[model samples]
Target: MRTRPVLKATEPWEKLVWWPKVMYEEGRYRLWYEAVPPDHWDPEIGPKLAWPNPVFAGLLCYAESEDGFTWTKPELGIGSWDGSNETNISLGRETVGPMGLHGASPFMDPDAPPEARYKMFWYGDATPDVVKAARRERPDAIDPRTTDESHVRAMYVGTSPDGLNWIVQDKPAVVFSSDTLQVVEWDALRKQYVWYGRGWSWGRRTITRAETTDFSRWPLPQDVLTASPINPEQTDLYTNGKTRYPGDPTTHLMFPTLYDRATDQTTIGMATSVDGVAWNWTPGNPVLPVGSPEGVDAGSMFVGIGLVPLPGDRIGLPYAGYSYPHKFPANLADSGFSWCTWTRGRLAGVHAQTEGEFRTPPVRLAGSGLRVNCRVQSGGSLRVGVTDEEWSEIPGLGVSDCQPITGDQLDATVRWSGGSKLPVDRAVSLHFSLRTASVFGFEILDER
Candidate 1:
C-alpha cells in the first residue's frame, strides 16, 4: 500500500484535525473532519477542562478534492470562528451545542428526499431536558458513564441537503456516548438503517451495532465485534470504520483502529463480514502498520469511513495520523489526514503455493462471462472451468480445455478452448485451479 499526506493542520481551528469522513459524489471527493482549536488543550486550561469535555469539543470542518490526492478547504462562510465566518467549518459547537461533533459519520441517503439526501450519526452533548426525559422514560438506553449533574452525552441523528448545512434532530436518537466513529449505513437488503459504534466488552472498547427502521429512533447499541482470547488483555478495538466494499456491497469491511493500552499506541486493523453484525479479523492484520518511532503516524492512526475509488484502478482509504500516543496531550500532539491505496479489488487474495484447486458453491450465472482479478507469477498459472450442480465437469469446459491465465490483471477474462461464453441464467459452480498464483476475486460480466 502507498500512503501520502493530503491535508495538514494549517487553519487556526484545525490544530488537531482528525476523524475524517469522506465521500465521492457528483465526480468530486468531499471530506468532513473533526477540527479542534489549539487553545482547547492549552497547557494551563487543558488540565482543568477534561478531554472530550463539553467546554471545548472539536468542530466539524469540510474540504473537497477534484482528485483524491490534492484537497482544498474552501471557505464555506457557514460557521464562525473567533468572530470570523470565513472558515471552512461545516458544523461547530454553536450549531450542535457546547459539546461539539464527535465521530461524525456522514453518508448519502439514497432513500431520502433531496432535501435530506445526506445524513449523519454522531455523539455530543444532549440537552438537559432530553437527558431528563431519557432517564425518566428510557433509562436502559442511557450510558451510565455519561451520568453527570452538569450534562449528559448522547448520539444524535441529523440530516442535510448538501452535506454542509445540517438539520439536527432536537432529541437524542440513542442515549449513549458512542465516542468512536459512529458509522451508519442504509441496509438496502433489510430496508433499515444499520449503525456501528463503540461499545464496552470485557471492560474494553469493542465495536457495537444497532439497527433502526426509523432514522429518529434507535435502540441501545449491542456489542457485536469484540476482543478475542488471542488478543492481549490491554488491547482493544476502537473506532469502527465500518463500510461496504465499493466493488462488492454484500461484503462488509472494517478498518478498526486497534488500541494498545499497554503501549498507549494504536494501529489500523482489518476485519471482514458477510452480515454486518458478525465479524472476523482478516489474516496478517495491522494491514497499514505504523511507521518508525519518530514518524508522523508512529503514535496512532484511524482509517476513514469510505473507500474512495481513485485513478489507475486503485482504491484509496483515507486516514488520520497522530505523531504522538493516543493519550498524549493534544496541545503537544501533531496530526493530519492521509490516504493509502490498494490495487482495485486486490485488498486480499487467495494464494496457492503448490498445485491447488477449489470449487465454489452453486450460483446462478446471471452474467454472460466470468472475469477474475488475479496475479500469476513466473512458472505459475491459473485455470477456471465450470461444473454442474452435481460436481460434474461441463463438456468442453474442463480444466484441461481451459485457457491458462498468466501474469497480473485486474479483470482477466476466463476462457476455454470451446468457448468463453457461459450458460446465462443457469445455476452452476465455478472451478478454479491454481499453481503458485493468487486469486483476489472474480466478477460476473455482462459481456461475453
Candidate 2:
C-alpha cells in the first residue's frame, strides 16, 4: 500500500483528540491525550520549560467514535488531584511533576482472565520527592552532578475497570531522567508488559524500553534499539529519537528515522516488527517518502505517536499538524491540532506479470556461445536471446517472450545464469533485467 500522512493536529482546543486506540469490545475507537490550555505557561522560568508549566497541567481526557472517523468528547470531569473519581483512583491526582496522566496508551488486558478488566499505562512526570527517592536508591547509577533537570521525569502506572475512573499505582512502572512516551501490553509470545520511553544520552535524546511479567518487580532495560549513528564521533548522523507501538492482543512498534534535508526536511521513515527487539526495517529509500501537502515538522510537532491498523490492511495515522516552533510555543501551542487519514491499496497474490531481454553491441549467430545471467525478485521470467537483438520472436525456444516464474506471497526471488550455443559475429553486452507489474510491501532481490 502507498502510505500517506493520516491526521494533522492544528488547534489548542483540538489537542483533546490524538494517539487513537481501538476498543474491540464496543467496536469503537478512543483517544487518550493531554489538553494544553491557552496561556498555560509562565514566561519567568524560561521558554523551554513552558510545557510542564504547572498553571494548566495535563487533564487526561477521552474522545470516542464508532467508525473511527467522527468523534465526540464525553464530558465526564472525573479527574481530580485527591483521587476522588468513582472509578478506582489507582494513582493520585497530585502528580509529582507539573502534569499527571499525560500521554497514556490504554488496552484491554489479554493476560487477565476473561472477567478481569481493562488497563492503561500512563506516562508523565513524577513529583520531585518521588524522583529523588528513586535516584537515591541508584546513587551509583544516577549522577547527581548532572544538572539536566530531566532527573525529575518519571512514569507512573494506572488502571481502570471501566474507561472512566482510574487507579494510579502508588509506585511507578518505569522512571528515567527524560520524559517518557507510551506503553503497550506485550503479546503472549513476549510474556511481559513493555513500556517504550525516551530519555537523555549524555546530553542528546534517545529511546529505551523496559518490561516486567507483573507491573511490579520491573527490570531495568535491555537494549531494544538505539538511534545513534554507526559512528557517533561524526556529527552528521543522529536522530530525534522516539518509539511507539500497539499494546493489545497483537503487538508492533513504529520505528522512525529522521531525514534532515535541512531546509526541506524529509518524511520520517518507518519500520514494523512483531516483537519490540528485532526490528525489520523496510528496504529501498523509505516506506513513506517526503513531499506532501501535510503540515511541516519544523522545530516542533513531536508527532508520529501511534497508528490504527485498518481492516483491509490499511493504516490510519494521526499526527500533530502545525508549522514548527510556533506550533508548540510555550503558552499558545494549543492552536495546532488538526487531523488527516491515509488509505492504501492492499496486494495479495504474486504472479509473473511480464519479462523481456535485449543484447548490446551486435553479436553474430555463427560461433559465439551465449552466456545469459539473470536476477529475479518475487520470481519472474528469464528471457534469453542468441543474438544482439531480442530473439523470442524466433521459433523453437519453447518459452514465450514473457513467462511465469513466481507468484505473490511473502517475498520470493531467484536468479538465472546459464549459457546457450550461438554462431559468433561480434562481442555483445548481455542485458539481463527484472520487471514486475505488481507492488509488494516487501522485496527479495537486488542486482548488486
- Judge candidate 2 at residue 164 and give its lDDT: 61
User: How well does model 1 score by local distance difference test?
Assistant: 0.83
Tens digit of lDDT per residue, candidate 2, span 1-448? 3223233333343332233334434566666555543323435532443344443344555666665556656556454432334321223244323344555656667566543356666555555566566666644333244354443544556566776666566665545443333555554676777766554454544455677788643545543544434313321211212333223433364534343434323333444566666654444323333323443433333333445555443445554433434213434322232232333322122223474433445443333333222224554444433223543323322233323334432333322233223334344333333355333222212222
Clashes of 2: 39
RMSD (Å) per prediction: 2.1, 11.6
Model 1 quality (TM-score)? 0.94
- How high is the lDDT of residue 325 in model 1? 84
Q: lDDT for each of the candidates? A: 0.83, 0.43
In TM-score terms, candidate 2 sits at 0.60
| Per-residue error (Å), model 1, residue 102 | 1.0
Tell me the tens digit of each residue's lDDT in model 1 across 1-448: 7466788789987778888888888789999988878666666644443454522377889999998888999999888888999999988867886547788888898999999999998877676788888878877777777668366678888999999998989788878878867789999898999999988877888888999899988888888888655667898888878887775779999888888898888878788998887899888777787867776788888778898799889998888888888887766777888886889998898899988888899888778788899999999999988888898888888888889999999989889996757777578899999999999999888874
Question: Lowest summed-lDDT stretch of 10 residues in model 2?
Answer: 231-240
Q: How many backbone clashes does candidate 1 have?
A: 0
